[model samples]
Target chain A: MEVAEKTWGLMKKKVLVIEDNADHQAIIKSSLVSRNYLVVCADNPSDALHYLLDEKIDLIILDLWLPEMDGLSFLKDLKNVPEFSEIPVIVTSGTFGSEYDILKLNGYGVREFFMKPYDPAELVETVGSLLKKTVD
Target chain B: MFYYTDPKRGRDMKRQKRVFLIGLLAAILGYLWELYLIHSHPPFIFVKIKPTWWMQWVILFAAWRIGVFISGLWKTQPTASSQKENDREEELKYLSRIYQDLSNSLRLEKGKFEAVLRGAPDGIFTLDEVGRINFWNESMEKLTELKKEDVLGKPYEDVLTFYSTGKLVGFEQGTMEGSSSSEPRQAVNFFSFNGDQSLSFLEIDAEVSGGKEFPAAVSVSTLKSPDKKNTEQIIITVKDMTAQKEIEKLREEMIAMITHDLRSPLSSILGYAGLLQNPKLCVSEEDRQKFLTALIRSGKGMLLLINNLLETARLGDGKVPVISEPVKIKMVLEEVAENLLALAKGKNLSLSVEAKDNLWADSDKDKLHEILTNLVSNAIKFSRSGEAVKITAFEKAQEVVISISDSGPGIRAEEKEYLFEKFSKIKKQGSTTGLGLYIVKKLTDKINGRIVVESQEAIGSTFTLKLPASKKASSSVQLSLVGSR
Candidate 1:
């Protein structure tokens, strides 16, 4: 059942990769490309915000840390934005377990948290499953 | 000598001396008569009599003999009396010595015990059976300001001293009852130590010895000194811990600052990623893809950095609860590799997994995941394009080894030593937070795992994680390793 759901959900799914490092960026893009995701890239918050205002984003794979504006702030702003209020944001970062930070992000309504250098297949599967749930 | 000081004994000695001289004269007369009789004896009795000079000499000799006999008897009399007196004096001396020893030992023992009690970070005191002060150490003195002399003999209610918030504590009825042996009751009382300094706070501990058999509410403790046999006594150890409590408050405040620092950037990246992913923005296809991709990658990267910071801080604070479970090595490796596969492929690197067998070890699942992911991710990060990264998991003897091999330039010998240290990054200048490997090491240690990093300059590096099959095994191995190295 999970396999069938994942296979079906993989069709025409969108994945957003938020990273500041060029090398990291290229790696994430390639991975999503292999998984057949319509991958979107952003180096910082400003460019990411511009894209969010324009695209029909299915799922947001948010990074906890970013240049200038951070992932959490970006999330909070997104929650406030009328068009993006209903979107699900999965918070991904290597920085986790800070009692203070986790609470803040949790308060801002981040659905899930994955540490960096994350699992690529799991990310794909999770993104696919989440999109399927939204479709259902 | 003592008799000399007694007038009655002196008078008796004088009377005895007079009797001795009279006896000497009578003995001399008797001796002269015997000589006279001997000279006048018949032929069968064949006796001879001495001349006047001889008689006189005999009398003198008899007198000397009498004198010696009298002196001897006199000497015996004094010795007999002295034996009785000496026996009494010896007993008294023994008692005095025992008293001195007891006092010295009590002082020394109390001194050492009191030193610990006073130095304890908690407040402590002892109340006698009657709730009186039988033994009060320096700490009690400083805490109550009532000297041992003042409170030693006073009843519990009368001399009971307690300083709460720098004020003398008042005792209520039933506070001084000695506990019974069968049902020992420790009248636990919590009080706040009021002081001008920041040491004002409530302390919690039971009154060790209740008012009954174990009276004195001595925080029931033992005193083991070489000179003194092991003895159970009431020893209460308390620290103000108020400073510690204050430190906790300060920690919470500092945590707030850290949260602010963490959330500001994390939220922005997430928010911007959400904004860019919205289709209503009508952005160009190429630009939109680029923007969304950056948003997600940065968001995940930022999240990872935050996770590392949190994990390290939690482990450092000794607040991380370790839940040991049967953890499958393949599961973790598979998960980590699958996650990093995209990144490796993006660099055109071959990310292979050599963990075919399902190797299981008892560990904290989350912590193990953290260690494995960090090692593999680091391997991928430092590797050049077209290079290969290998992750292998297998069991060797009693240990489970999870090794990550990379084709990147191996860590420098000098740098390898400090590679796992916090904020020590080989990537000199970049957006990297430098907490990845350090977090991994910390998490691994928490789960009682050994981490070995083998690197050669310009060659590939391999990070090996060895964890015991059981949590107990891990701890023992870790302890031995620590002791040996």
Candidate 2:
């Protein structure tokens, strides 16, 4: 039974959500937690960096507008780090995503882009599929 | 040549001829008298006068010559005086002709200069050496609503007041009493302080007639005398910044609405509502309740933002109606506090109100409630957990005074000037629209009340609102609802 629990723990994927809005953080956490994934939340980029340094995060959910630094700058900082560069990121924004923003995110190897007012079910499915692809 | 053509010289020649004729007649009469004496004179008179006919003829000829010489001397004397008078007349005529030509050219040049100033889009005026408005252009007239005849020779400070960065500028003290040296010095100081060069545009606030104020870009140039040491005149050019300011405000508002205000709340609402709807996800009853509450909160926030936007537009168009009536100050304060209770609780702040007994104000209840709600909510938003937001009301000198105080990170002194300006967010965080205080100020002004803010950095802020007290004497005093469509 100990070996089985260990295997189960190793199989679960961890997601770090960097969002300022409490409601968005809670909803995303609930959705991911129900699917048996580990979720860590940070409300700012500094805390997000601390979380990234402390743990082996498999995926990242980033909100664009943040308290200390914006998500794009944080993402660039993350990409520069060899340890966290391999983690896939899905960007969500409150602004209407322009084509230029999408292209820029794609250039940064963003896994997905979601404008606000997005459906939570769709987001969960995308998260699942992106995580599975990373595993593959 | 002038002497020959002169009418006065011709009159002198005629007078000279008359004198010669008179002399000749007198000489002929004397000659006839001699002849009579020679022919039939008394024997004794003939013996004393002449001896022979030859001697008598010689005397007659000599007398005629002497009379002609005397006539010549008289004519020359008159001619000298007449020649001086004629030369003076010619000199005066020539000078007058030159003067006419110079004045005509000067008038043409003046017309062109005036036309250029009048047709210019900018407001242009000139201050003379004595600090009076000597020239005011058409644009200046249109801008200030003061005619040239009215403002000409008036002191510039009395006609228009200019402010640079919220401080009065562009005029020195004692300018109205004709203190000449100080005005040019102040103008030069104002320009040189703004730029390295003497001429540069300075953004200023111009207050015109009827106490109306607008943003203006003013450029100052001194018209120097030939020596360049003293400033002869100060030329000011003003461009209206109202249109540019409006465009900039609209752009900022659109960006804030699209990026933050409208979308942030909508994002929360959608995310929370979607989570609640997804049955496949095991949301417990408690989680469900939390999600529902968040949804309601976001919806209410969005509704408030939309209403504030509509109110701003209506207020801009002057379409909002004001129906002033007696309202109990304490009751309105309680209603606003109740409306914002949840917001305060969410932030872990306590809301309190203090008012005198039977405190009443002459105001519109709905507007008063909105103003109080905005102020109280702003207080709660800025405060830390466990801090108290206080609302106090009292009667003082026939007026109802209400103040909202919060122990938040108080606004910096520099940020206070634009605190009530549209979209002037000192701290850009969260879902603040930055329109709350602006709307509150507008509403207060619309209802004929005054709002004042006092704050210190890291201490707190208090917004005091004053309104007329409810009294029978003031019941007949009606508010001029000119803004209502």
Candidate 3:
């Protein structure tokens, strides 16, 4: 049996929030900040692509609708890359049509989805829970 | 006709000639009668010598001159012919202008009506009681992709069958099937169809009347223009609410996405936070417990958020069903109190439920339990340490009122409007999930109950839940049905 490697130090997990709406971005930021997580905001898919290339993103908060390229395609493109393929993307959308779009995103290995008017407390708790589950 | 310069205007000259002939004849006849009297009688008896016809004619002409002088009756019409022609022309012009003005306004009104009908988004069609399509609008033509030639005068059922499949589908079954011989009105039915071209859903509401049926689904409401109660024809207005539906769809998607996305990384954060709570990690005992407590708090908060999202969705779609059955309220209350005891203990609040035996209600067990749990938990959460959380059950004539009152600072008058609204909580100096009261009210309403609030902001708030006398009536109905069977 291969011996399992263990690390003693706590690694800060980086969160990439790809949302088109500015208000929604603010909500994600405030909740993640309260939980003491490093959150990065990208308002469009192009910016998200640039961030993914430059930064080692641990998880993603992706909105399904974005200008030019949407979050679903962004998720698919990132997943296609060997190094970034394993990153979990949580899809968020404000419309029902976009929700149906998220179902397609799920096939791309999205972890979960958050609808807007989301509770700030729930956002914090869910993020904590998702991160905790990953570590375990 | 009298000779006049303009012969068409000879009408005035003819009238003057008729009057002159009558005057001359009358004067000549009067003179002849005087001459006969003089020849027939003696000198003393006979009338004095009377003027001849020519003398009388002179007198009549003098009288005519005097009338013309006083009233100017014979003023020139530029010769009477021109006057008559001018008057006739003016009258004809007035009549023509009135006719033109009326026709123009009528045309404008018709054009306005046609414009409105064409521009309206809802497909409007008129159907007879026998289900014949009599009138179809431009919008209706576009909506069904059928031209007026194809649909007008065809039976609606035939159209529905042709569109749906080869079989006849009894399109009017819901509305027409339920008439008792004496049942006054046909029941209205609302139906929805998703078009094949795109998945756009069309809602149809139809009504039947006086054998002249008018059914349109957009509003699903009877048209208000013609009073079905009095008028022969039923006019229905179909309002296209596609924009409204789109907005609602957008809202639903937003909620779903936000909730889903928040859960992903939140799980990771919570997982790491929980790891610190392990004593094996060499963390201090106090630190371990603190992290664990924080983890639990965050988990609860997240659950509360998710519950709010779900509740909002359910409320909008009207999908919440009230499943009521005979269940003991006392048992439910006891169970709620037991579950809440631990939370109450933490605050040192005396949580107790007061109920009488044999108190039963026919209600959805799950919903009742939820109502009780929310009230009890809210009472314990809001109360100060050592305060009391009381649950009391009593009966009114048709309902049983269950009240949960806490001694914590109650709701204020200003906050009362939003007390049961989603995410609304009393501003307390502590951690709280404002969804409990909202769930309480919503669940209560589902079970056909009312919630009354009694509160003084500084003292505390009391929530009284009223449930119907469902047990007796529902049980009897079930028994009667079984007996009939």
Candidate 4:
């Protein structure tokens, strides 16, 4: 009776994907959706920021190379805002970045980094762990 | 002649003649004055001696000797002057011979240079500093299909008269309309480099004769004067790299296709494995078999792709040997038809074979099977639903011909040239790698066979392969005919 009350009351958290590739976005969407996590997609940082403003986003999955703005700038701007600062961002890139860029992104409170073609299973586990930490 | 023609030398000769005349005139005047003075005033009678008969004889002898001495002086003056003139003429003749020799050697050297330039297989054109075509060779003539008279003095940037407005034609200008693999315009930038610059090479896909654009590797080297001090001309060597570039592009495209093709099957295999690994999922024995079967089909598709790739690599080195033994062509066609039945059924295609009894040819058994399989498979892949593909084999003289006819949309007339070329992609929707016909052509060459394709758009295509008949098969057939008679 207690489990039913808790499950029915709280809705699934929304995760926004900032990816440009159609196949990668589809794969991310299907994987997350199959795991019962609400997913949203955007091709760039600016559109993803709009999602963060309109919807109650629990976490952000970011890609570095974007049309309008990059993931680093988005992270910097999001952190400056008092309301969106708490949401953790995960950086995923097709291009393997240098050590300095990874260290710098980590200092920005990024939860984790994944290089593409990443294992979909590991991605799910990481997302689950980060969300669990956020709830706690 | 030179002394007369030259004003300076003529003036000296005239001055010398005038001096000689004045000396002669003075001597005559002095002689006449002496005669007049002696006649007017006679010498003292005591000092003057009267002439006798013996005195007359001595005077005569002295006169004769003096005459001889004067004649000798005259002869020496004339002979010395004539000798000097003769020496001058000989010197002039020697100089003229040297001049002739130098000119002949220069002409021979020029001929040798011209021959070397024209002998080059690549287009060699020497451009002046101002971009004028100072020298054009025979290869350039062939490459541009422009005659020497037309292009020798023309400018590098030509304005074609084809367009009424006189559109300018530049070599290998860059635009985004080219293929995705097009490089930046750095190669042609060598032409625009500043004065007396270091040598550079610029390769481009130039539109040559007949508006056909082919890739060419151009190297620009500055031709300096004989002393190597000043830049004389720019020598541009244009090597037509069309064939090499085509192979490279095909290789890249094939790689991309292989990656994409491999990914689809890999995705299926991964999905199946993921499902099987799931502890929450339950599977039936029948479902397992179906999954296994799907995996096997995907694996076979990958295997066929790998096989085609291996064949391409093998054929690239040299021709593989063919076993010249008697083999029945009918069996090969039947085998190909049997294999393509499932594929034809999927597309609802009618596949049929017409062959003479035991129609044999001297060819490799396995290679013949492979050739039939490729042709029949291609036919089925291209044919629409309910359309029929026919395989027919016959014998004419010492050759055996097997023709595969398809009801697919046939190849266009223009596309036939590239049909057997490596990496040629005529159809967009091909299941196999695009090197099918190229490999078939190579294999046919191994058995000294010939292959030809006859097609009309919307009508269909017929591919024919002809190989020499084995002697044994012909002799056996002749023996059977005699026995029947």
Which candidate number maximizes lDDT?
2
Fnat per candidate: 0.02, 0.75, 0.00, 0.00
Candidate 1 vs candidate 2: which has greater DockQ? 2
Which structure is stronger by DockQ: 2 or 3?
2
Across residues B1-485, which tens digit of lDDT does each residue of candidate 3 receive? 22223366444555555455544465555555555654655543544655566766665566544433433244443557767887788799889999999999999998998778666777666655445667677876655566778877886655532111111122243333323443233333222211211222224323221222232334222222243332222223454445666667665655544544345335423443534533323445564564454445445545545665577678668888888787777778888887666557545678777766667776888888878877877777678777888887766787878898988888878989988976563446333445667778878888988999999977998999888765543221110000000
**Docking model 1 quality class:** incorrect
Q: Which CAPRI quality tier does the interface of model 2 achieve?
A: acceptable
Tens digits of per-residue lDDT for model 1 on B1-485?
A: 21122264444454455456656665776566666665654522434444476766676667656764565455344467667876787799899999999999999998997688656544465543334445655655554456667766564445442222222223222233333432222233322111211222323222222221111222223333455443223333334344566667666654544553455345445444543454433345675565565555546655766787778778779898888888876667778777666556545678777653456798988888777877877787778777888877666788888788987878888888788876663453124455788788778888999999888888889999998874322221210000000
User: Which sections of candidate 3 miss by over 4 Å?
Assistant: A1-136, B1-14, B18-88, B91-282, B316-318, B337-359, B385-388, B392-401, B413-425, B430-435, B456-458, B468-485
Q: What are the per-model DockQ values?
A: 0.05, 0.46, 0.04, 0.04
Q: List TM-scores for all candidates, in order.
A: 0.35, 0.59, 0.37, 0.48
Candidate ranking (TM-score, best to worst): 2, 4, 3, 1
In angstroms, how far off is B194's CA in candidate 3?
Answer: 45
- Best-matching candidate per DockQ: 2
Lowest summed lDDT over 10 consecutive residues: which window, candidate 1 chain A?
A22-31
Q: lDDT at B326 for candidate 1?
A: 82
Which stretches of model 1 miss by more than 4 angstroms? A1-20, A23-136, B1-287, B345-348, B470-485
Residues A25-87, candidate 4: write the lDDT tens digits: 655665676677899998777688789889999988887655456678888888899899899
> What is the overall TM-score of model 2 with all chains considered together?
0.59
Model 2 Cα lDDT, one tens digit per residue, B201-267: 6786788756688888988877767876556788889999999999998786667554677888788
The alpha-carbon root-mean-square deviation between model 3 and the true structure, to one decimal in Å, is: 20.6
Best by TM-score: 2
